[model samples]
Structures are given as structure tokens and as C-alpha cells.
Target: MSGNLADGERAGAARPCLEIACDESGSDGENLTGGNTDVFAHASVSLSVTAAAAAVRETRDRIRSPAEEYKANHLLREKHRAVLEWLLATDGPIHGRARVHLMEKTYFVVDRAVSLLLDDPEGAVTLFREGRRTFGEEGWRAFLDAANRLLRVRPNGDPVEIFYGTADSLARAHPGTDAARILERLAATRPRAESYRAGCADGPPLIPVLNPLLPAIVRTAALWSGDGRPVTLVHDRQNMLTPDRIAWIEQTARRAGVGLAGVRLVVARDDARVQVADFLAGIARKIASDELNGRADPALTALLRPYVDPASVWGDARSRALLADPVAG
Candidate 1:
């Protein structure tokens, strides 16, 4: 929203607001400690929920990369060690494997966000001091800064928000909180499991503006291979995303201050009112194809459906089937 501004003012102020989310999915790794299974390769995704943008360039960057090491343990070091090392510069209360719990690189994604906006990063720490101090924000800002800088993007004026959740939350939750049932479920699995039922257990949060860090969150929504490597960038490509996915992605776009509807108006004026829905329609058809071919799971595709438009999301099908559904054509 620009108003009463000189030409340069509008140009410089064209920054976007973004709500970012990052989460990692881990499969049951073969190696188990005390019956606890380590997470497999840690993957990350950063999404921008805006009017007419996506991580297509970023996604292609990832896909184009020559297949390389995708192992979690190999890439991620323990956070305690890194933090403690910075704290003491030598041995202290925490040291060695016994003193610290090894964490994956995924844990650092949020911290990256914080470093983006803050100078000394104490800017974030001061905010934490106001709370119970579960964790510091400075580290997150630093990580975020690194990401933005890595992408050669400026941070100022781009509204950014971040959080961590899990696929467990996306799954249907049943009533009757039973500790016994929970314990039993964990015991039944060959590999041990941990659930964050309290934090972000209420389904995936919408981060409309896809920013530098959103890939980390969207990673959770994608389909993972046997080793937890992300197989599909968009989950909705699995079966047939519904109007529901379009509806949600619409919210995400609006929340991020990116105007897909507006973009369609300028670039895709033909039935632009339903461009978002049409884009998603294509994504849904892809998901259906994958399901029939055993390439992806229905649940995963359902999530991707919310992010694409029916008519142009996938963009093709001179010979593809067209649905005579309510909103189509």
C-alpha cells in the first residue's frame, strides 16, 4: 500500500512481509540408541506466502544440485557444543558426548532467522529476557541473516515471522488424552518416537510470505523417501488437491502480503478471479497420477494442493483431462 509518495519512495518501500516456518522430517534410521531411532537426513524448505510468488527458483536450485550427501547426522552438529564452545571458548559444564544432546542442523534454522534483523542479536535476547527464556532469539536472527545474505537479499522492511512444528500436528488428533496409549504407541514402533503434542500441535500454521527460511517449514509438508530425503517439493502433486488447498494457500498468500489475485489481474486477466483455484486443479491432478503410479502418498499431496493454482500451477495439458466441476472454466 503506497500513498502520496515520490517515485523513489514507492520503489524503495516495495519490500514484502513474510511469515516463515521451518521443520524437518526424520525417518526411522537403522541405528538405534537405547531403542531410540535417530532421524535420517534433515531436509529444509522456505516458503513465501504472497500474492503471486513461489520458491520455484529456489526449488530448482535444490533439485538441480548434483545429488550429494543428504545425511542429517553428517551435516548437523550438536547445538550445545557450538553454543557452549562460544560461551566458554574452552571446556566448561558441558563437554563431550555425555555432556550434550546431539542436535540436527534443522534445529538451527530458527536461529538463522533471528540473526537476519538484529545487529548484535542481543535485540532478540532482550525480548527473551521478558519471557521464561526457553531459548534465545539472537541465534535465530543470526541464522536468518545468514540465509538472506546467502540469497543476496536485503532484510530491512521485509516483515518476518518463524515457528517450528511437526507432521504429527498435521495428522488428525483424537480426543481423550491418554498417557498410557501414547506410551504404548511409542513402544509399538520399532524405532522410538517423540511427539510435541503441546507446541504447534494444532495443524500447520500458514506462513503466507515465502521467505528465505520457509523451506525449512515446507519440508515437513513434502513427501519424504525411506531416508527422509524430500522426494516431492509440493505434496499436493500427489492426488488431487481440492478447493480447500487453494483456500488455504490463498490465506497464506494474503498473510504474506503477496497478492496472487493481484498478480493474476495484471498477468493472467482471463478469469483471474479463479486463477488460484485453477492452478491448484493442475496440482491435484498430478497428485492423483502419482498415487495411481505409487510415486507419492495421498496425505502428502493433500498438503501441496493448498499451494498451487488449478489452471496454471502446473501449467500444461493441451491433452489432459478437464474437469467440468463447479469452479472450472
Candidate 2:
């Protein structure tokens, strides 16, 4: 595989390729607003097919279900708690080999609205960081709700109309408040809404704003390519990873100095590694969502801690504290 030279490598030397299997849980395509899941998780694992299959077999041996194939739900059952623990244990096959990127769906929509509509991404992030304090909890939720409606692309709706309508409603609802000020700032970027609408119309019809999978894939590639090796992702078949999107991912990663050789799509049932990745992604999503809702199982949360990527796009104070505190229950 070809990639940028690693430190201490000869300039023209070929870089080794690291093949990773990937799958995601809670993908609702661009429907992050009212999707079945509150969290989106993308997982990648650097394990050989044999190793992955062996792990799966081990899980099956412990669970002993009659199903032809196993899935994350099988492991997530209350009766299979020990099996789940064993899978996430440090000595487990997946421990150091897997990484998961989790995105809280609502937080993702808010981030997209801020980054797309505001001039300074950093400033937008800062505004969001202090959003709860600056605006009351109700006001902040109102702002997020507005942002979610504004960014959600509807087939028969005008983007500019949606943008102005949402902004006006939010401003009216929270007049003389920080939320209203943020809405004003967002309204100033009306042209961006028009441009985004035009781009979507001119393209293969993809939601750059609402889809978290695209960024998650790029992050996963970069994480696996840290050694300067080109990463070849063997992913489960996903409609969102179109040819144009894959090309975009590669180009974007290259610009960021990541060596993404390419991505290969395969059927999950046919790929054992991808199946293992599905388990990791699915389990991580469940644990994280539970934590966010204040119904966390301490044992499961502790087991899930290590697999979560540090760059996960979670905005909840509880999630932040859990990730930051090693001894957190």
C-alpha cells in the first residue's frame, strides 16, 4: 500500500497496510432527530479474520443460543452479563484491538448547526460549552431543538425558509437571552444555508450536516493509521459510504496527513471481523446511552470505558465525567 513516509522510513519506501474491520450501530441515515437510538457508534477492529471468528465462537460457546449467527443483542442480554464482561475485559481479544467513536445524536445536530452556520468554529464550540450556564436549561434545550429542526433536510422543504423560520422562532422564544443572540449570529449566515441547499441538490443527495458516520469513519481511519501505515477498512455494506463519499473520506484524511489506502465493503455475515466490530459498536452505544440517561450499570460502564475513543462526540456532563474519572461509578 502507498502512504506518506513514517518517521525514520526511506522517502520512497512502501508503507505497510493495516486492515481493519468496521461496523456501526444506531445508524438512522440522516434522521438523528427522532431516531430509534440516541447515540451513534462506529467501531473498527484490527484483528485478523481467524482471531475475530475465534472470539465470536467463544462468545457463542458461553451463550449457547441456537441461532445460526450471534449479534450484540445476544451478548447484551441480562443472563449473558458474564459473557459481556469477558468480551470487554482487558485480556479479551477485542480490548486493545478495537476503538469506537460515539456521537450523541442531539449534540451532533447542535455541533453541525454551529459549525456550518457560524464563522468561527472554535467560537461556536465555546458557545456550546457554556450554553447551559449562559442560557437556562430550558433555553438551551430550546436552542438545540431549533438547531435540530433547522439542519434536518426535508425533501420538500426550502433550506433558507427552514433556517429563517427556526431562527425567528428561537429568537422569539428566548428574547433578550444568550440563545437569541446565538440565533442572531446564526441568522447572519443565511447564505450558507442557500449554499448547502444548492450543494445537496447538485450532488448525489447526501446529508453532510446530519450524518455522523462520515466523520466517525474519518476518525477511525486516522486512529488506525497513527503508525503512518495506510489503513484499508473492510466495512459492512452501508448505503451512506457511496463512491463519492469514500473518495471524499480518502482525500480529507490525506489532507490531514492520514494514510487511508482505501475502503472495501463486505457483507457482515460473510466477514467475521466486521461481526466483532458490530458487537463492540452496539455494546458501546447501549452502555453510553444508559450512562447519559442516568441508568448506568457500573460494571458494564467500567468494562466499556477503555474501548471508547477519546475523540467521541459526546456533550453530556455525565458522559464527560465518566470518561474523565477512572474510578467513576
Candidate 3:
């Protein structure tokens, strides 16, 4: 195992090599409202398997419990604060960077294709016109509400400009055109709109976990791929994420031109590195949930914020910049 890592590192001189351990929290998937966890967070750390295992082992020993199991949930207690502090400490021996993708489930329940709409200016205009005609002023208000939400929250670049420009152009072009006609035009020309129409029969297909998961992978890979070395990812196992999904992620990476060495799955208990990933994932979920509820714990926020890759963390300026990157597009 050490030899493999060494080989990877040496090869990385020509192309960087990154070993990633990943874990998730609040992953109830399509059944978001049915679960206690209202957010989904995919967290990862970039480090060799050996170093990450050592870090986890060292932290577990510091906790000083004879129990064989040590999970992120255990660290929520006051006594386990040291474990969190140690893992995120700059001088700590963890020897890696941490990044997480946070999805507020409620936002999705409100509108699953928010990102799609943001990218589809024509769709936004069509919805706005239809909404106004169907429910009078109230309907237009609601459509605008949803659209504004997407514009404000989406990581995509300069959404306000795109949204306003498209909407204003539509209003001017159609003038007093009938809402039904506008819908027909949108259905004919807007591929996303057409796709949604075709798929609506299936009840707006459940937003796959991979939607958020893939973005996280892309962002992380880009951040760590400074030297163009291959990135190898190992994610904590989930029954729902079958082999097909793994294959899809790999294929997507290939299409995106990401140098992916491999993708592996493992049980958290079997891999100490994955346990460290669990800790980061759990913390991210907590912070995102707290911010959503307007009850962010300052101390917890303070502890994790420094270690978090601001460019990858949702809602941060650095993350917005990443969103603007064509590669992410």
C-alpha cells in the first residue's frame, strides 16, 4: 500500500497525485422530508490512505475510550471537542485539505431543478409569463419568488444579469403575446423546457444524489489538481450508490477532463481515513443546517471554517468564483 502511494507521488511530479477519502452526512436522498437530517453534505479529505489512517487512529486514542468504534456523532459531545479541534488545526498531523458540498434539502423540495432554471434563461421567462396569466398577480409573484431564490443562491456566475436580461427581452418581444403561445414557443426551442415536459409524466424524476455529489467531485478535483496529477477517490459505502453510479462518476470525470486515477468504496469502520471524512461531513451538515435555521453555532463555525476550502464551500465567494469556472460548467 505504501509503495502504491509512493509510486503515485513520484509519478505526480510529472502529474500530481491526490488520494481522497470521502464520506457523507444527511444523505436521505429523495426522501429528504421524511428524515431527521434536512441537509446533505459530502465531505472529503485529500491525503494518502496511510496518513489519514494514522490521523484517525491518533485522534481516537486522544479520545481515550477503549471502545473500538469512534464515529463523528460521538464528537458532538462536549468531551470530544478536542478531536474536532485537533483534526482541523493547521499544525495538526492530518496532512490534508478538507472540502464539502452542502445541499439544503428544503431548497430542493421547493424546486428540484433550480440549477436547471438558472441555466435556462428562456425557461425562467416562460415560467414567469405563464405564472402571471394563471394566477394573476399572485402567480407572477410566486414565479418571481422562485426565480429570485435561484438567482440569489445558485453558484453560477452573475445570475442576476442573465436572469434580468432574458426576462426583459422576453417581455419586450412577446409584448402582449398569449401565455399559452409563450409556453409553446418555450417547448419548441428550449431544450431543458422540452426535456422537463417530456419527463413530467414521471413526476419530475427524483433529483439523484449524484447531482450534488458530482459537483463536489469536480470542485475538489479542480482544487487539488494543481500539478495535473491524477486524483484517486475513496468514498464511504452507501447501499443506494450502486456500481452504475460509480461508473457514471468516473465517466463524467473523464468527460470533464479530470485526471481520475480510480474510485473506490469502503465501509467507514474498515477505513480510518473514511472515519476522518465522516467527521468533516458531519460538521459540514451541522453548519449548513444551522445556517439554514439561523442558529449557527459560532464556536463550531469558527472551528471548521478555517479548514474548509472556501472555494468549494457553498455560498462562499471563493465557491462562487469556482462556479464561474468554465470547467465546472
Candidate 4:
């Protein structure tokens, strides 16, 4: 639980990377006519130290839940439930102690990035444009700091890398493609990254994530992103209990070309597989304690405060529920 992959392997640990890939899809096919939302899944196959096919299956067996199988419909529903509860406690207007704690932690990440980016506004432009730079010298330095901070741990740490899949980075991987274009428009509208990058505020990389094969609603979005780097595909608030749907999403994700994972929460709109409200709410429930008396400590509060609700036409009812929960948090 506390070592890097290499260190764990050296210690003869059981599972190394804990690679979990999750995909989300609907009967409506992930776009356009948005009726009949069918399924979503968090499919994970853990490979063990033996590095054999048998180990792979074993890993899959150990981690695979009835809710984590190829059949995603049921899993999808359950996950949604879990996410909904989380949203209610943490981000709901009323103070859910554990929910606030998670929000505060979440905000730190954005705050750290924004601080670095805003340090030298002019410098950011030159580093990005003039040089075909993958993290310019300054950027690389910042990257190292961010990476270190992100990977570090403490007592009662967040075990899951819940937000691994990044949207801008993903779209950039396949620039000029349909998905990329849609992401571009999303970049303009989505403020997810604004808290982190000043440049993002100008022409943001946080764009609408889409599956290119779905030809139903093809809109022009930002095409150039990530600069063709390896970006992880994060499925937010996924519920995949059905094998058939899970299989379809697995295949679809592969066709799109990116690593995927099942994340409990993410911004609700766009292609983010999960809902941000749900994730925070889930964390609220997970960390809730009678001793805290419904008030998340500074640490817990830090983790949950930053998540803003991403609502569609009707907005999110899930976020409101957290507020109604009894506050022995």
C-alpha cells in the first residue's frame, strides 16, 4: 500500500500496478439522442508478480466484483448509487463533514497547479508555443514537484488514484480527430482546469471528452491537445454490471487508444464517466465518523470543497441529497 511498483516488485509483492480499466456506454451509444441510458462499467484486470496468464486471471478474479464484471448494467447502477450518496454528503449545500474534507483535498491539487501556472503568466505562453516542449524546463520542474506531491502519502491516505484519466491530455493524443474537435469546444466551456492553469482560462485544454466512433453528434471542438502524449482514460461514476455492455466499452476504449480506469467520481457532464458530486459524496460516507460529529476535519474538508456540480438541463439532484443526511459525520 505504501511502495512504488518497482519497490513492491523487489519485495515480491502480489499485485504490482493494480491496473484497473473502466469504460462507460449506453444503449443510446454515448451521444446525440440522449434517451435510454443503458450501462457503464469499471472493468479491471490486475496482473500479478508471476507475470503469467494464470496470474492475470487470478488477479482479475481477486479484484473482480459481481459489480465489476463484464456485465456492467448492474455494476453501473450500483456505482451510481454509491456516487449519489457521496455527492449528497460532501458537495450538497448543507455541510457534510466528510464530504467537505474530500473537497478540500481535491482543491489542493487544483490550487497547486494554478499557483505554479500563475507564477509567471508570460513564461507560460512562451514555454507552450515557441518550443515543441513537453513540459518546458520550468514546466518540467513544476511537473516533478506536482508528481512528487501527488504520489506522496500520509496516515489514512487516499489509496485510489481516482482522477488518473485527464481529458485534455487524451484529446491531444489523437489530434484533428473527431473526438479532439469536440474536446476543443469543451475546452472552451469546461472550467474544470481553470482553477489550475491560467492559460487554461484563456483557451483551456479541459475539453469535452468523446468516443470518436459515435458519429451521431459530431461537433467541432479543440483538435490540438496533449501533443500526442500517453494520457490515461478515466471513467467517472461508471455503473457496469452487465458483461455485454462492459465488453462493448472495453472494445470501444481500445479502439480509441488510451489506458482506462474506473473512477468513482468526476464532473457529471462531458465524457467524464462519473459524476464529481457522487465521488465526493462517496468519500464523505467512507470517511464519516461519529467522533467527528458531522464536521470533516481540515484534512477531510480540503479533499471535498473544490468539486463544483456539473449539471445538465435539470441540474444534479444527487448533489442535494448529501445535505439532507444526518450529520454525525
Q: In each prediction, how many residue pairs overlap at the backbone (N, C-alpha, C within less than 3 A)? A: 59, 0, 3, 55
For all predicted structures, in order, the TM-scores are 0.18, 0.86, 0.64, 0.21
Give the number of the best model, judged by TM-score.
2
Candidate 4 C-alpha error for residue 227, in Å: 21
Output the lDDT of residue 173, model 1. 30
lDDT of 4 by residue, 1-329 (tens): 11134543554444322222222233222222122321111111111223323322332353365533222222224344443333334433222211121112212223333334334333333322322234344533333233223322211222112122232554466566543443343345324333333342355222212222111111000010012222232333433223444444444444655332222233234321222222333343333321123543444333332321111011112322332222221
The regions of model 3 sitting more than 4 angstroms off are 1-13, 108-111, 115-211, 311-329
User: Per-residue alpha-carbon lDDT of model 3 for 1-329, expressed as tens digits?
Assistant: 11134443564255445677788888654444445886677777766578878887787778877778776776666788877777766677642366666665544332343345334444443443354555466534433443333323222344344434444444554556554344334333345533444454455333352245655656555555544567888878776557776676677777878777777888888887788888888876776577556676767665555445544433233333322222321
Model 1 lDDT tens row, 1-329: 01123345555464332212212233222111111322112121222233213222222243343433221221123332232122112232111100000112222222232333222234233322321122224542333333332222222332122111111221113223331222123223211111221122355333311121233212222211212222222221211124454455445544644332311111222222122222222233344335333565544343432222122211112211221111211
**Comparison by TM-score, 1 against 4, better one:** 4
Model 2, 1-329: lDDT tens digits are 11345579777687668899999999986667666999999988888889999999999899999999788999999999999999999898887788888888877877787878775655555556666675667766656665665565654355567557756776676677665677767777878877876776676454367888888998999888876778899999988889989998888889999888898999999999999999999999999989988898998988888777777886665686684333311
Against the true structure, candidate 2 reaches a TM-score of 0.86
For model 2, state the Cα shift of residue 43 in Å: 0.5
Give the Å error, residue 101, model 1.
32
Relative to the unseen true structure, what is the C-alpha lDDT of residue 230 in candidate 1, on a scale of 0 to 100? 20
Stretches of candidate 4 above 4 Å error? 1-3, 6-19, 30-33, 38-70, 73-329
lDDT of 4: 0.29
